[model samples]
Target: MSCWKYWPEIEEIAETLEGLGAENIDHIDELNKIDIEEVKKQLDRIEVIAHDKDIDFDSAKHILDNERMNKALKLIRKFYLYIGARLETENAQEIIDSDLDPDEILNKFHFYERYEGLLENESKLAKFNENKTFVFIGSGPLPLTLIMFRKKFGCKCIGIEIQPEVAELSRKIIDKLGLSDGIEIIVGDETTIEDLDYDILMVAAFAEPKERVFANVWERVTPKTPVLVRTYSGMRAILYAPLTDKQLRGFHKEIMLLPIGNTNNTSVLLRKIE
Candidate 1:
């Protein structure tokens, strides 16, 4: 939460961990929640600010009890602390080897990325067909690509997001833009590979790297499913299903890169045949 109250503890912990010569770190994801060291670092700073301002537990508790001033201080700080504690730990190095929840981090990241702020009206939606079911591998800035596809092809879209926040945002954006009926956003990984019969699968390459881990996650289809993948720069060499092929493609003749606050030279669109 607020670095004002938790900074000292976090720093102490980080320093202690540092002294212990713990270098490697791992992520924690439970119930679509991410436990990250960065958030813990921020909490440590917040604790520092709290001490500098002479604010203590009682003061924070008081402010939190009030409704009016809660937004500026209490609410933000409290949630920050809650999230920080959930995602991070003092002795992460010792547990780094344990199973980490990648999906939790992905879902949270997805939720934030999708609905952090208002998207301009100029942003386009990906193309899809309602009559067909499609799997959206990644929900990045180019989610519009999927939206457009849904509108044109009548496809039912199952969008998988890495971050819970981004997934929430995507849901909000879909609801706000009146696209909810067509797209079903799921905040997690696709596990049932063999059972999925998606007519097509779409993904944003740059958004979800290290995709090799989930390479065969897609389920088996009858003959082949059309997978249209988009990449910002020149496409990296990635093998697809047997009958798939790559081609330079774009929607609305433009694609947005939200993180960089710009657009791309061209979106590398791939069409997977089998």
Candidate 2:
């Protein structure tokens, strides 16, 4: 269910998409064909409605639960991800080709400030075992999450990246920071998980086809192992796909949802119940 209010605003955005010739908003291919800027404008308006003070939490949740609205939100999120990935790819290529310090590049990442706030939250920090190891899936060029986890928890970390160049660059950054002893950067995806041992699994925010990954993790990891799935909530839901109930089948029902700072990003904590 959605946690967003302002049905009128959402309806307007849906109408706009439909007007643009979107036969099925839930289809990613159709959404990708639409002009990104137009989609972004609609998303911006939806965000404003999400933050409106007059919209109560219960009402927003009810609107979000509507099937049609949910499909529209999913399409918007796909467009957002498409645009973001294109931009990120361009930026990563430029950074990799430049002589800029890795530290400086890491500092300039958009999510750096938000992550700092999240790392400082004691209640959320308590959820992880400080003495255990962690493996972060989809660890990108910077591996900031692994860096933060190591610094804050004093725990060992292993980052899995699909891109060889990104994995190499992340390793260089880790070595530059003298954190090589505490963290290891591996170049691969979920397949690499089998060769390593970790106490916790952290799913990166931009991880694609999360349902499949969650199922793979469930089958691979030991029972009761904690899995932290990072997802978007509230207004951010339009920019990132959140996990659906169908994808959570093998997990315990007693789940915990922790918001990261004041952002629409949240960490869904679950244990392998099967």
Task: Please report the candidate that would top TM-score against the real structure.
Answer: 2
TM-score for all models, in order of appearance: 0.38, 0.71
Error of 2 at 76 (Å): 2.8
State the lDDT of candidate 1 residue by residue for 82-175, as single tens digits.
4533432221221223344422332343223322221221123234346578776665422554565565566777777767765765665555
Residue lDDT tens for model 2, 135-166: 88998876777888888778888999898977
Among these predictions, the greatest lDDT belongs to 2
Candidate 2's error at 36, in angstroms?
10
lDDT over C-alpha atoms for residue 60 of model 2: 58
State the number of backbone clashes in model 1.
54
Q: How big is the positional error of residue 270 in model 2, measured in Å on the Cα after superposition?
A: 0.9
